[model samples]
Target: MADDEGLSNEVNLQQRHRKERKELQAQVQKLKHSIPKGDKRKKKEITEQIVKLEAELDQKQEKELEELESTTNEPSKVAEQLESLTTVDSDDVDVAHKVKENKPSRAQKRRDKKAQEEKEREKRIQEETINNLMGSRNVESETIKAILDKKGLQLFEIASDGNCLYNAICHQLQQQGTEASNDSLRKQTADYMRAHQDDFLPFLTKDNGDIYTSEDFEKYCVELEKRPVWGGQLEVKALSHVLHKSVEIVQAEGSSLIIGEEGKHCDSPLCIVYHRHAYGLGEHYNSVQPKSEETVDEFT
Candidate 1:
């Protein structure tokens, strides 16, 4: 009787495990289908969750099956006792068949194959994207380096933080005997933009593609002043005006920009290199220095 009770409890536990696993599998499928298109970051996060859940379910099922097998090693004795005590029905025979037939159904096999193909396809696309990006970056870096070499200049490495643009500008300023901190420069840039709202507001836009309202402009300035927000062409223009100096951005290709060309200090403009793929994150900037100024400890 005790052996029968133990076997029954084990069967019930297995059934519960199967039900929970089915529910989790259904949830994973739903999450996959509901993933937002073109949102790579969100998609990656969801994919991680799905992978974690699948791993946990597989591990739990394996543990439960191992335990069940260990406890039922004397299956012959249990079967003889059950036969002597109770009349086994067709349901018992069906359960025995299910336990023996551990292989997945044809439908499940097809689903697994489809899932594997999709996973491979995604992996291939990701690899190709990375390869293309790396190839493009290498070409750009070589082109920029050759151009800089011809001009007797080289890249001075800058930190890849959001404040890279401001830091690059500060480096140039410091080289020219003008000491300025990144925080001070950010404040000055924001102040210039705020004071010249008419000049900057038209160029800025809201998320919905509308021109920035006065409130939006104020909020932008506040964020720029207080946050480590990335500076772009708009900020470059404002900073040029604030510093009373021209800002020249040299790029790998195309015509480089020369902001504030009419400034009094245009002769010795602040020179910085713009890289579309210098960093994995996104756009980056580095100050330009004379090749002769390169030091042993300085990162180029």
Candidate 2:
């Protein structure tokens, strides 16, 4: 029986090794195409890489097969090891086995997502602390506040999650009885950036302040839509261009910065106040609301 099991294991190992070898051969063929024609150095380098990969795979297959053969040679030893592991309470063993069996890919994804969110929450708290130590508090100049008050605009705060900019825009749209979500806003922003790459790409830079390449720009747009990346002035500008709505940013210090063609957009614009440092935390966005006396329902 031990000999039969060992033979079966050897057969399975051979099949796996064959599959791996075929894959490596295909990879080598692809690499051959990429090597520069008439360049001996490039060809030699690619050939070396292919040989090294094939050798490694062969060595790994041999080692695994040898280990399996050795392990299955002594069935009594294997049984004794298994029996030792099973010596715990039967109920405990069953529960653990069931737990492992019942956990599907979706369950693992949910766990990973929850852990990521928790990490983000903790990061925000730490950032908030650092911001406080740096004396970053929500500060609006008297002039801007007076202008807003006189214009019958009230400030409605949005949560300072990474999605603050999108949430603020979505909230504005929802207030006017139009259904919108952060995902939709992000998609729109990404699409607009991609379509108008030339106009925006010049302004975008890497951390080193070098102008971003076309490929880098596309990658940035992709990550912007997929990840919980923080949105800033660039995102707001992109949203403005896509929505064809002038986004009036009433800042704490300077005059209001309006993004987009002033006269090309909507009649009643989408406006948000930009708090450089809001709630002693990071920069945040808040929907501009109209005062109760002057009811405004103009968000198209």
Candidate 3:
């Protein structure tokens, strides 16, 4: 009975100890709640430990993924290399599906046609400028023909549009890339200007600010010893809005054959280029007007 009593006392003591431990745990939880969370160094250390454990878990997952990929298909690695080196094969049987036909469409053709038309218009303007310049110089057909031949501009081409003699010839030379000397062009241009200065020829405006007319320019032409040669023409259009005002010549008629109007332009018989020579009129001749009556009396 005493032993039994002793066992009961021991059991009671154990139950009390357990109760005390429970109370101590409650007090410990209350104390933890009373302390500020981020203020304590030990709390920071516990958070760091938790983060470290999570990182370790993430590493384990990645290692599993890598292992799985390594155990899978043999071509997985080689597929990347093959894709890098591969080009679409034109000859392969099924490649027709992947091939793209690059022929221009109807719309593209229309655009090209419009572009071609614009180019043709610009080229036409350039040709007209050259013609106008030639016209002003009174350059003759033969001289012009000679220069054209020298420039390798003797050929003709059939244009889908109607072609001009000048355009056809220049086009042929341009296609052949003929070597035309600038000096020749200039010299020929000048020679023509001087020879026909009397015919109210157009000139590149001379140093003097004067304009000449087609008829009255004969007085100046009388001074030229050589017949004029026609060189190609050049039109001086202003880089800006104004266009085609200036003409250029290497030599001028007389001091200047610029014929702004016709005064002495009709003074020619053999030379219809001018109306009449100043010497052509009997009014100016010593035989006709007789210089002066005083000189006539002295002679008598």
Q: Could you say which candidate leads in lDDT? A: 1
lDDT of 2 by residue, 69-136 (tens): 56764779766645876768988878876986787543356457757987999999999888655653
lDDT of 3 by residue, 120-144 (tens): 9999999987985676333533343
Off by over 4 Å in 3: 1-100, 137-300
> Cα lDDT of model 2 overall?
0.75
- Which candidate number has the best TM-score? 1
Q: Is 2 or 3 the stronger prediction by lDDT?
A: 2
At residue 150, give the lDDT of candidate 1.
87
Q: Estimate each model's TM-score.
A: 0.56, 0.50, 0.16
> Which 10-residue window in model 2 sums to the lowest lDDT?
291-300
Candidate 2: segments with Cα more than 4 A from true spot: 1-138, 141-144, 279-281, 293-300
Better of 2 and 3 by TM-score: 2
List RMSD in Å for every model shown.
Answer: 8.6, 17.9, 39.2
